[model samples]
Structures are given as C-alpha cells and as structure tokens.
Target: MEDPSLYFPLPTIKTLLQTFYSSFLFCFLRVFPLCLALLFETLVLVHKWSFLGHLLFVSAVVLYTTLVYHFSRPAPVYLVDFACYKPPSHLQVPLHSFMEHSSRFGCFEKESVEFMGRVIKLSGQGERTSLPPALHYIPPRTGHLDSVEEAHMILFSVMEDLLAKTRVNPSEIDVLVVNCSGFCPSPSLSSMVMHRFKLRDNVKTFSLGGMGCGAGVIAVDVAQTLLKLCSGAQAVVLSTEIMSTGWYSGKERKKLMLNCLFRMGGSAALLQSGPQAARVAKYQLRHMVRTHMGASDRGYFSAMREEDSEGITGVSLERDLMQVAGEILRMNIGALGSRVLPLSEKFWYSFSLFHKRFLDPKTEIYVPNFKLVIHHFCIPPSGKALLRELGKGLRLKKVDLEPALMTLHRFGNQSSSSLWYELAYMEAKGRVKRGDRVWQLGTGSGPKCNSAIWECISPVNPLAKVGSDPAGPWFDCIDEYPIAMDDF
Candidate 1:
C-alpha cells in the first residue's frame, strides 16, 4: 500500500462551503453597519445638522467600532519568564563513573555494559550531565521514595527560581500544570506544587503523565487554552522526566537507550493572558500546531512501555523510531506552514504538491522555507543523529542548530524540558532580541510532533544574574558553547 503520510489532507467541499459562508456573513455584518452610518451621515448633512451634532455622531460610531473589535478578539497569551533547573555539581556523573556504576550492578550482561558505554560516548552528551542522587548510590536505590525525592528536588527548585524572577505569588496562579512522562504519584505533581506553595484551593490544576517528551509543549497548549477561558488569568507549567523509577534493569538493548539518553532536569514557565502582562512579558505566543499519528500501528508501537522476556518492564525504542518521527514532523510542519508561511511560499508549495500528485508523479514536493518566518529554532535535543536529520530535513544552517547541539552536549536529553534548555542557551548568549520569532519543535512517543511559535515582545538580555543568584542555567558556560560537532 502507498504511504498515507505522502499526501496532505485536502479541504473537502463541505469545509470550503463553510469557509465561504463564514466569510460572506462576516463581510455582510461589517458592511451593513458602515452603510447605515453612511446613510445617517448623509441625512445629517442634508438636514443641515449642527457641526457639534455631526462630530458627536461620528465619535459615537468610532467608539462603538473600537469596542466591538476589542471584545470580539481572544485575549493574548504572554510568556512572562521561564527557569530551568541546574542540578548541583555533585550530581554530575562522568562517563567512566557512569559505566563503572552500571557494571557494579550485576544485572547487566557484558555486552549490554559495552553497548551502553558506546551509546553514551556517541550520544552527544558531555561528561558534566547529571543523574539523580539515588542513582549515585552503590547498587542504586530505584524505588518510589527515591523517585519522589528526585521529583521534589527538580520541580521545587525550578518553581522557586521562576516565582522569584517573575515575583508572581502562588495565590495569584489561576492554573497549574505539571507533566512527567514516566511517573505519576498518588496526589499528582500539580497538587504537590500547590501544597508546597500554599496556593488557592480553587486553583485549576492538571497533572499530565505518559505523554512522553513532547508533553512540555502539550502542557503549554493546555495552559493557553485555559487562560483564554478565564480572562486575565495566570498559569504555570512544569515539565520534567523522573528517571529513578524509570531505569531499565533488563538486558534489552532497545529498552536501554532511554537509560543512556535521558538525564535529570526540569523547567518551569509562567504564562499570563492580559494587556498588562504583555507589557512586561518576554514573548507573545504566535502559533501552536500539534500532530499525532497514533492511529497507525507503526506510529503507536514506535516507542512503548513493555516487559522483556524476563518480565522486566522498560520503555522500548523501536528501530524505526527515526522514520516515524520524520513522517510526523513533516505533517506537523506542513500544517504550521499553512498558518505562518507567506503567500509566496504557500503558493509554490501548493503548486509543487499539485504537480507531484497529478502532473508528474516523479516530481518532489517543495519544502517551505520556515527560516523566512522564524528567527531562531529550539528543536528536541534528543540525540546527535536525530538533530542532524532534522537540520537536514528543515534546511537549517549550523548556526540555526547551535542551540540544540550545544544543549545536548551540556545537559543531555532532558525529555520534555530539553526544548526549554535550548531556548535558555540562546537567551544566555544574548542572541534573542526584541521582535525575533522563535520556533520550538518537540517530538516524542505516541509519535507526536508539536510546534510552538513565540514572538519576542521585549528585549531579552543575557541572564547574567537571575535575581542575584549569580546567573541563569548556562551563564557560566555560555561563552564556551558552539563547540565543534567533531568533539562529541
């Protein structure tokens, strides 16, 4: 069978008719009022009304039009600030230490030990990447208590930093969203955050689990939706992956990839919707597009949690993961391009699609130049190979991929929070300027691809001092970045 993803979904006759009808109705409503105003003005002119009367009438019309336009539009959402957790240097596990620790565990076979070592060395992760304190112990303490401790350390630290920087009281937070792909406790992470900060009882709370690395953007999408409903509300999203309980003890190489790739980290961001917040916010949300291919068997099983022959449970990474990721990414960007791409690019892309489908089956489809609309990119820093594939597919230059590559080397794959770390790297380097548009692309299990666009509304200086804490996550090492890819 031909690939279903090869063709984009076309608008049906019903959809076209709905669009036409909406457009006609909107135009008629707008024009009818203007025609009435014109008629009233003509009557006033013919009747020789007083100048003051005419001025009052025109002012009333203008005022009414402004109010209608203002109330009709949805409130804008703003990203006030964000913070990424920087674990203590004591938690840093060098490659040799990590290998030694793994070998110390008698559960792994010799070949599995060697496989993990090779994966780590070529994984584009540096020696300074951190692991949880529990993992540092001999024989490793992988249990419920240890997982909760790790979660507390990461989630609370990032939340504290974000709250301090934004100075927004917990009582004022109208919504709280906490996402951890692998771990979900009894009370929920969102409830834990609320209790820790003593937030309002009525605060809207949501805890998302099993959504994989893309859940960060998914959580932000959820917050944005809620903010629209509650006018002038503030929301906070916390993203992280708890790996203490997620360690794979089995010999399955596919399951072991997660052990090598994921590291300890978390991020918290504050988003608010209102005119007042926009004045002080860093970025204004522009567009968000999410694509899911879970309906297909290959996509659904691409990455899944299951047991080995020994019944040792772990998340498996199928060999075809990259293929599935590429397909989902293509569909996601195609949807996003329709909304953000200029008319010229859209026209050529549509023409190429038509030609390829009808005129010449051999013709290749055109890839829209996203760089035309986006100034910076923060794609998932999952691994070097995936990053390289995405860079090539998107036609991104080395400079454009610098943030992701460097973030991977310095912090490893933080799962949902990896994209935020990449964004932080860019800010710490003083690269993000006012009016620059940033695109954050995230992909994960469920074979999902999500994209978020942010327009910098105000200047973002290098985070030299985050509320007198000395510096941001990358402040100490920002100057040393843009390292040669060959070094990894």
Candidate 2:
C-alpha cells in the first residue's frame, strides 16, 4: 500500500456547508445566553428596578448555567485493571517442533509443509507461544467439545485473574461483554461468564461474534456507551479467539497462513463509571474511533473465512489485506486526530488542506504528529511487515514500535487479546507513567480499524506487585526483551 499519510480527501461543498452550520449553531448557543443576561440588566436599568430584584435575577441566571453544564456532560469511564492469560508451559509450541509435527500428521502435502515452515521461520513468533491442548494431538481433535473446553479454559482463567486483581465482587458487575470472532455456541459466551461468576440477575450481557479481532475495542466502546445510561455502573469486557475450532486442515496456501500465526490467549478488562472509580482507576478513557471498509469488494474479501477448493473451511488472507488495513487505519486516525490533536497540530493540518486544495494543488498535505498527544501505542502485531508499514506511516520511532514487536515475539498473535498483552508489557517494564496517554489500535478480518485513547491516572508498576501476584504475561521474561527483531 502507498503511504496513507498522503491520502487525505479534499473537503466537499456539502461537508463544508455542514461544518459551517455546526460552527454557527455552537456560537449562537454561547452568545444567546450572554445576550439574555444583558437584556435582563438593561431592563433593570431602564425600568429602575430595586437592587433586590437585580440580585435575584443574576442568581437565577447563574443557577440555570450551572444546571445546564452539569446535565450536558457525560460520565467519565475508568479502567480499574486488566489481566491477560498465560498458558502453562506444557502448551508451548516450539517452531521446529511445530514443523516436525505438521510433517508427521500425514494430512498435509510436502509443498504445504514447506510453505508453513517458511512462513513460521520468518513470522517473528518466538518458541514460547502456545497452542490449545487439542491442537497438540497428532491428528488434532477439532470437535465441538474440544472447542468448548478451549473457550472455558481461556475465558474463565482471564476472568478469574481480573477479578482477583481488581478485588471486584461478581455481584457488582452491571454489564458484561464477551467477543470471540470465530466461535458462537448455543448458550453464548456472555451467558457462560454470568453463570460461572454468579453475577447479578439484572446485568446487561452482550455476546459479539464474527466481528473479527478489532472487536476488543468495539467491546470497550459498547461498555462505555452502556455505562453512560446509568450512574456508577461497572462493566467487564472479555476478548479471546477459540483456536481449536478455528484450525484448518486444508492445504490451500492462503488458508494455511492462519495455522502459522494465531495462538492461544485471552484478556479481561474491568471498567467503571463515576468520580469514585476515577480516584482508584489506572487510566481514564479519553477518546474512541472506529472505521469499517467492508462496503467495497476489495476490503470485504481482504481477509475472509471461507471453504477452500478442497471443501475445508479456513480464513484466506488475500494479497490486498495490507492495502485494506492501511486505508482503514488512515480513516480511523483521521477522525481521532480531530478530537485529540493539539491546537497547533490541527492548525497545520487544516492549513495544509487549504493549501493543497486552493493555493497550490501540487503541495503535499500534512499528517498530524500523533506522538504529540499519544505517549504509548499498542497496535496490532499481525505480522512484522504490517507493523513496520504502520510505524512508517505514523512516523513512529523504533522505541514506539517495540511494545508490539516484543508482544508478537512473546505471545504470537492472540487475536483480540493481543492489545492487552502489549499494554501489560509496558506496565511490567514500568514504561507507563501518570498522565501518559496510551493509544490502542486494532484491525481485523472485517477490514476494520478501531482506536482507543487512555490517559494514565495513577502509577502502574506490575513488577512491584509480582511478589504477591506473578500474573503479568511478561513477569518472567520482561528483562530478556528488546531483543534484535532480526534474532527472532
């Protein structure tokens, strides 16, 4: 894909008119209040009203303004804590061992085995990444029962850890969201969580499937929206992909890519609303932006799950996958920049747009420096190539890209839960500080991209608490990281 920073669309006449109208309405609302206050003062002076009457009128205006401001603002959402599941050592699949097992399975042709081996060798995944117990079987048991076991193992483990870390009782949860892109059983994952945790009877539960890896951020957005309708509500978002059922036994090269990349992992996050939660929260929600490009054929099919020619089902990543990702990411960040960028950054971007559109059509448009607002980034680590491309497009330094690269090396691609693992890595290293802003960017099979901005509200040091809880994904291996990307 070409550099996405150069692809800003020119403003159309209709969009310009809408912008003008909105700006006028905002100004009118502000000026209207002042105009009414002035008119009341004029009446007191012209009619020679008593001093007590004027005082009463001024007090009423002040009360009205205070009420309007209080009612118009939305409640703030806080991230109390989050946890990522770390599979037992027995489940780790070393690279060479994976290739040896594939060769002996007898289901794959020699060419297919070679293709997978080559992909894994250059895939940037380390030997410690894990696979489900069912996948470790010689023939791979991909039955419904096996998939259910995988789901329970991951979902329950992450939730248990999260609840323990946050010290939040199950009865206090008012909302539950579970997102797994490839699995949707009869009972639904949300129901399973509620039953296992014995949550309140009236909790709002949501189970989202087939939304792809970006669904993690989508789940956060859903929880935030629901919290706004009630006071002091708590919500939990569980993100995972059940790899047992997602495995493909086919030989098609496109379908085989999934086998080399995805691994077993999951994450659970606790979010709460209101001022009380904010006092103890680690991070405060700042902004969220989502973009979907599935309307066009190229984007919709860029990464899709379908049956191969041999009648075996698997996800096929087309050649245009990178192109679609770049396009959607550009759109998502463009919207986010409008909300979070500093005033100077916005001015330069707008000036460039005007210069390119009217003053000089040949002039290059400016891409806002996101680093000015974002202190840390947790981006999708689908592969090394995609990560490198995104870093270049966003003008990020190598240090800014290390968290994602190291996460991929340590855990492979855990689908929706990968972002949390990256964040956990930062926390374990004590790289996140109070007042820092962390941006999580997620992309998935829908050719969709979503962004979540979080402002750190308190100190986060997982290593300091490791003595009591050795739960961080990188608690054991953080010191070994920042290894040369080439070494992996």
Candidate 3:
C-alpha cells in the first residue's frame, strides 16, 4: 500500500506558517496606529484632514479583525499513547563488553578507565568471545531468507508482548511503520511485519530503512502524521538495528567499534489519536527537527566509514565523530527553536546573540543554556567524551546526565532504544514527574541529527520502568552503577 505519510497534511508545516503569520500580523497592526498617528499629524499639518480620517477608519478595521482572529484560534492538542515496548527474549545479550570497548575510544582518562575496570569486576563477565551458534551459523555476507526469519523471530516476540500488555489484537493496527537501519531487503520491513502478524489487507504500512539512529523520531513523526488522517486508526512503530547483516568482520579499530558498541535491540510502540489512548501516557509530540549535513562523499565520509575492501558494509565511526555530532546538534537546535522552544528561551538566546554581535564585539554568544528548559536528557552511546562535550556545551549538570549514563552502563547503546532506556531510567527513579519535559536527541549516518520533545502528562506509569517487569532478572544490580575497566 502507499505510504500514509505521503498523503497526510503535514501539521508541522501548517503550524509553522500559522505562527509566523500570526506574529507578523500582530507586529504589523501594533505598529500601524503609531504610523497612522504620524500620518495623521503630517496630514493635519499639511491641511489634509479628510484623507487622515479615511486612513484611520481603514487601519482601525484591520486591527480589530486581526485581534478577533488571534484570540479565537485555539492551540492544537496532540495526544500520544505509549504502547508497551518489549524486545525479543532471544536477542538479550547483555552489553558490558560493548560498553567497555566503545567508551575506550573517546578520551579514556584515568577515572573512566578505573570506572570500566569496576564494571568488569562487578559484572564478572568475560569479553564477548563469539556470537551464539545460531547467529554464527548464518553464512557471512549473504542476505538470505534466514535473515528475514531471524528478524521475524526478533520482531514477533516484541509484537506479541506489546499486544498482550495493550490488549490490542495483531489484526487491529491500522498503520504499521517499521524502521530498521540494517537488514532491509525486498518487500520491506513493514510488509514483513504485516505479513508475519497477519495484519488486515486494509492496513497501511511503510518501511523506512537506511536512516540509522534518527529513524526512531522519524517513525514517531510518521506516526503522528498518520494519526491525524484516520480517526480510530492506531499506528504501530518498530525501531531496530539489524546486527545480523552489519556485523564487521575486519579487525580495523574503526570497524571493531561497531562490534563493541552496537548490540541487537528493537522496540515496538503503539500510537493512536483515539480517545482510549488519550487516557494513557499522552505524548503530545509537539515538534520534530531533522537536519542532514553530509551530502557529498567528503561530508558523508566524515560520519560513516565502511572498512571492507570486499564491499561488505558497516558503520565505522571516525575519531572525531562527536565533533561532527555536536555540529549537527547545533544545526538541528537552530531549526527546532522557531517551533518548539519557549519564548523565554528564545528571548534569552536572542538577547545573548545581540549582546555578542553588536555590543560586545570581541565576545561570541555562548550557546544558550538549555539546562533550565531541559526536563530530562538522552544522548547516544558515542562515548564518554561525546557525552561530556554535550554536557559542557549545553551546560548540563551531573544529575541531568546521570540517568543516561546509568542506562548506557546497564544496557550499552541499544541504538534507538538508548533514549527509551534513559527515559525508562528516569521513570524508575521517579525523576519524571507530571508536567516535566524530555529532550530526546539522536545522531546517525548521512551525518544527520534529529530531536523530539515530549511533555509529560498527568500520570507517570510505574509499570513502564525498566527491570520492573518479568524481564527484571536479566538486568544486573542497579545499586552501584556499572563501572567498566577500573584498575582498583
């Protein structure tokens, strides 16, 4: 079927225009009386009182109409329900080794090294020697049906779990959006999901691949769009990285980083505009900003590296990955500010900019402090340096970053799931209260960056906490944070 997002009226664009025009009209009318009074004075001085009265009547009518329209229009309310997210039981490979190895690449000072050693001592697990026999059995570099079968095994397990928790039937989902950065083949991931789940023929489905980490928010954006067109239509979103296909066989340090950092992870989410879901976690997806920086081979080469002479493909991040990431994050923030950022923040940022550019010629405006507006934060599993750079740039505190660090220590970088894990951590710790906001930032190939802002609703569900369900036993102890590679 045709992609649902292709046809829906984009509310983001519409809202942007609406806000711009409203602000423009307000300013235009506000200045009109002053301009008109000047004109009237000039006319009276020139002995043209009749013309002044005519202009005054016209301006008054226009100002009145603008005020009435502005006051009458109400703000839009988007209600997003969180369906249960369950990863396949089979794909659970704990991430101590991955976390240890990935963290090493970025500025491994004595403390971080000591921290890694502590994690190793705490987990008491050896380095990941090999994949399970089942995974290893798949012949190298050939995309086959077995890959799909394995993908299905991973997909269905999560789907079934979600269906059970939500009490939603497999056949009832009206829109299916699946985003898998790897292992995409003919018939697409969405079609495969639909076929495997036996979704109705009428269900609309879209498969988004090759979009890397930012795809999760891209999926959320697509779901938000689909929710608007069909009343009662529920959208199911699946985000996963197919490690089975992208496994790096080369011993290159860059290639090995992927092997070390990325693990098998997938998340299933259900979004619906229907009132039933409105009573749930109510994620009013206010804004999404997507910025793509790398179009040329040079720019693309900056973010993505594939280390095979035999044409095998996998992401090999360069040493300066975080530097590229910070640039993209800044670009995305600039685009998003016009839409999602509060006027208070805009005023502060703009004031700083004016002060730096015009008044203080020598000083550059510091990036506006995002810590105050940020309710919770999630950064990807690039490394400690990346996290530290982001914190320093954004002026985030230890408490602001601790939940994310804790999640990475426990879960490794589950790619797209990393943000969800961080969110889960906050919920577990009871840091996310009613009316709190969350900023989810993502980075990926195409040298891209994307962000989504979620405002908390009235209720924070306890059941959504990680390690609280039947899967709790799989997680290691939560008391002392996992400290990998500390030489005590």
**Candidates 1 and 2 compared by TM-score, better number:** 2
Error in Å for residue 343 of model 3: 3.7
Clashes of 1: 0
Please give, for residues 147-203, the per-residue lDDT of candidate 1 as tens digits.
999999989889999989988878778899999999999889998888899987678
Clashing pairs in 1: none
Model 1 error, position 109 (Å): 0.5
What RMSD does model 1 have? Answer: 9.9
In model 2, which regions exceed 4 Å deviation?
1-46, 50-55, 355-364, 464-471
Model 2 clash pairs?
none
Query: In model 1, which regions exceed 4 Å deviation?
Result: 1-66
Q: Estimate each model's TM-score.
A: 0.88, 0.89, 0.71
CA lDDT scores, all candidates in order: 0.88, 0.87, 0.63
lDDT per residue (tens digit) for residues 313-367 in model 2: 9999898787788788888988999999999999999999999999999998898
Candidate number with greatest TM-score = 2
Model 3's TM-score against the true structure: 0.71
- 163, model 1: CA deviation in Å? 1.1
Which is the winner by lDDT between candidate 2 and candidate 3? 2
lDDT of 3 by residue, 13-38 (tens): 43454455468675686567667766
Task: Give the worst 10-residue stretch by lDDT in candidate 3.
Answer: 124-133
